[model samples]
Target: MRLRYTTLVVDDYDAAITFFVDVLGFELVEDSPATTSTTGAAKRWVVVRPPGADTGLLLARADGERQRAAVGDQFAGRVGHFLEVDDAAAEYERLVALGVEFEGPPRVEAYGTVAVFRDVAGNRWDLLSGP
Candidate 1:
């Protein structure tokens, strides 16, 4: 079976949508009201995807303390996500111009060219492209 979406917890839905759509250049695939929970809080099922990607990201809002704490530390401060690009250098330069903060500069490796950058929520992501 093919994987569809991976959940990325966020502090706010609109903010996450803004980052994914406006900053990262993803398309908002869905944003509809979700099933009501026991807590009686309003929730929405949000999904976003890259320009032409098969897999998309599901944005989940922090509902409690534990979830809130995990907003930016989903993978405990490691490079938890990766976006394979057509050109690492070009993407790096474009992201930099848009004010995205990267952990360091892009470097070529035996497998590919890669650079580490942070999402708006501070989750680390690797932008890479094969040689």
Candidate 2:
């Protein structure tokens, strides 16, 4: 079976949404309902999909203490996921022009050229292109 969707927990939902949508060219599909309580304040979820791509991402709230801690430990200075692209260098350049910052330049690897970048909330992602 094919994979459906992947979820990422971020501290700032709007910034994360903006980065994925504006910088990476992903399309927004949904925005979470506004939260009322202090504990839930700024808590929201967003969904986005890559341009012309069926698979998508779910931007979830990193609100709960347990979840926030878990996300911090799991994704700390690490890529949340790796996305395959037609040309890693081209895509990296395009994203850089859109104000996206790269942790390292694209480099050739055994399977492809891989470049690391951060989302708005400092979540890492890898852009890959097969050699």
Candidate 3:
């Protein structure tokens, strides 16, 4: 079976949304409502998908204690997920030009040219070019 969607926990909902939509050019597939608990605090859960791709992203909440701990561990140099692109170098350059900072330039790996970058919330993601 083909792969489906992947979720990435992010701290700032609006910032993450803008980064994916404005910088990376992903479109919003689903705009989840702001959920609330008995305390009446609103929560956010947004999802976006890459252009021309059926697989969507689940922008999970990253506020509660559990989410905060999870996100902290991930941002502390743990890879949460990767996104495969047609040309890693080209995409890397494009994102860099868009003001998206990369930890380092792209390098050739066993699979292909791969680069790592942090989202607004310090979430690490690898841009990979499949072999």
Q: Which of the numbered candidates is closest to the native, going by highest lDDT?
A: 1
lDDT for each residue of candidate 1 in 68-110, tens digit (9 for 90 to 100): 9999999998999899999999989999998999988899999
* Tens-digit lDDT track of model 2 for 65-125: 8767755345767777787889999999898888887888899989989999877766678
Q: What pairs collide in candidate 3?
A: none
The 10-residue segment with the lowest total lDDT in model 2: 36-45
Please give the CA lDDT of all the candidate structures.
0.91, 0.79, 0.80
Per-residue error (Å), model 3, residue 79: 2.3
Q: Using alpha carbons, what is the TM-score of model 1? A: 0.94
Expressed as tens digits, the lDDT of each residue in 1-131 for candidate 3 is: 87677777777778888988999889987776686565656776688888888888788767678877776356568766687899999999999999987889999988888999877667788989976
Clash pairs, model 2 backbone: none
Candidate closer to the true structure by lDDT (higher is better), 1 or 2: 1
User: What lDDT does candidate 1 reach at residue 29?
Assistant: 97
| Residue 54 lDDT (model 2) | 77
